[model samples]
Target: MATAYISTPLGSAKLEGDENGLNTVTVLEQDEPESKIIPDVLIDAAYQLNEYFEGKRQNFDLLLNPEGTEFQKKVWSLLSEIPYGKTLSYLELSRRLGDVKAIRAVASANGKNPLWIIIPCHRVIGSDGSLTGYAGGLHRKKWLLNHESPSRQQSLF
Candidate 1:
């Protein structure tokens, strides 16, 4: 397994994976250098992430292999279908997954999403139209949503 650290708006993040795909993306309090040499895959991931943060890219095309339970995988897969600049409620996500009662599970799966912007777990919000739990932090989630929907801003002029 190969691991690398990359900087983001939220903080420094640790990415770990191999040829199988990306396994984990963990947020860290501070930047930490990897003991091993940075692999091409991790380098590519960092570059893509930088582009994403710069608003130059709206979607990610890197290889990913986030580990999770079957249900979580299903939820994450559905999350990827949400278009850029769009948002969905946890209940809506649950409904799309064929069970409105699975809202809790769907939210849990969203929280466990390992690919961040690639998988778009940040798109999920509360049913009442409020920002909800996000592992990356709600402020970052709001920033992501706003970045994607710049047109929604009200002009003072």
Candidate 2:
């Protein structure tokens, strides 16, 4: 596995992956030094992430190889399909997965998502539209959601 670190508005991010595909992109609570030499396999991932933070990119287009159970993978797969700037409730996600009764299971899998912004776990919210738990923390989740929010214009005086 190869590793690289990059700084974001929220915090420093650590990316881990190799030839098979990118595995994980995790944001750390504490700032870390950026990688001086990013691995070739992760170069694109780093670049794309930078573009995302810059608001120049909306969707990611790279091969991913996250490690998780079949159900978790399925949940992550659906997460990627959620359009940028949109949110989905946990119950809605469970319904899409064909089992409203699996809301907890769906949420568990969502919480376990390893790809961070790439898999878009931050897009999932509570049924009441509240920002819920995030592996990177709720603050970062709020930052991500706001970053992805469509630009709004204010009335000129």
Candidate 3:
């Protein structure tokens, strides 16, 4: 697997992938050195992520190959269908998955999402529109949501 680290507005991001596809994209809590030379296979992902942070890109078009169980993969796939600047509730996600009773399982699978922003696990919020669990921490989740918010706040100079 090829690995590359890049800097973002939130923090350092670690990307791993190869010829098959991108395996994961995660923001590291601890600071890590950015790669001076990104692997060829990961170059697109790195550049897209940089564009996302810079507000130049909204949709991702890189191949992904996240590792997970069948159910987790299903959940992640559904997450990717969520539109940019939109949020979905766990209950709604469960319903979409065809089993509202599987909310917990759905939430568990959402928590295990490996692609980070690319899969858009951050777009899943509480039924009450509250920001809930995020492996990258709620602060990062909030930042991501605000970054994707349709209404951008303008600053007066």
Misplaced by over 4 Å in model 2 are: 152-157
Per-residue lDDT of 1-157 in model 2, one digit per residue for the tens? 9999999998899999999999999888788999999999999999999999999999999989999999999999999999998999999999999999999999899989989899999999988889898888888888888888875243111
- Ranking under lDDT, best-scoring first? 3, 2, 1
Report residue 6 deviation for candidate 3 (angstroms). Answer: 0.1
| Superior by TM-score: candidate 1 or candidate 2 | 2
Please provide TM-scores, in order, for all candidate models, with all chains considered together. 0.89, 0.95, 0.96
The global C-alpha lDDT for each of the candidates, from Candidate 1 onward, is: 0.84, 0.91, 0.92
lDDT of residue 133 for candidate 1:
90
* lDDT score at residue 29, model 1, on the 0-100 scale: 66
Badly placed stretches (over 4 Å) of model 1 are: 33-37, 152-157
| TM-score ranking, high to low | 3, 2, 1
Task: Give each prediction's root-mean-square deviation over alpha carbons.
Answer: 2.9, 3.1, 2.7
On TM-score, the stronger of 1 and 3 is 3
Worst 10 residues of 3 by lDDT: 148-157
lDDT of 1 by residue, 72-120 (tens): 9999999999998889999999999999999998988899898878889
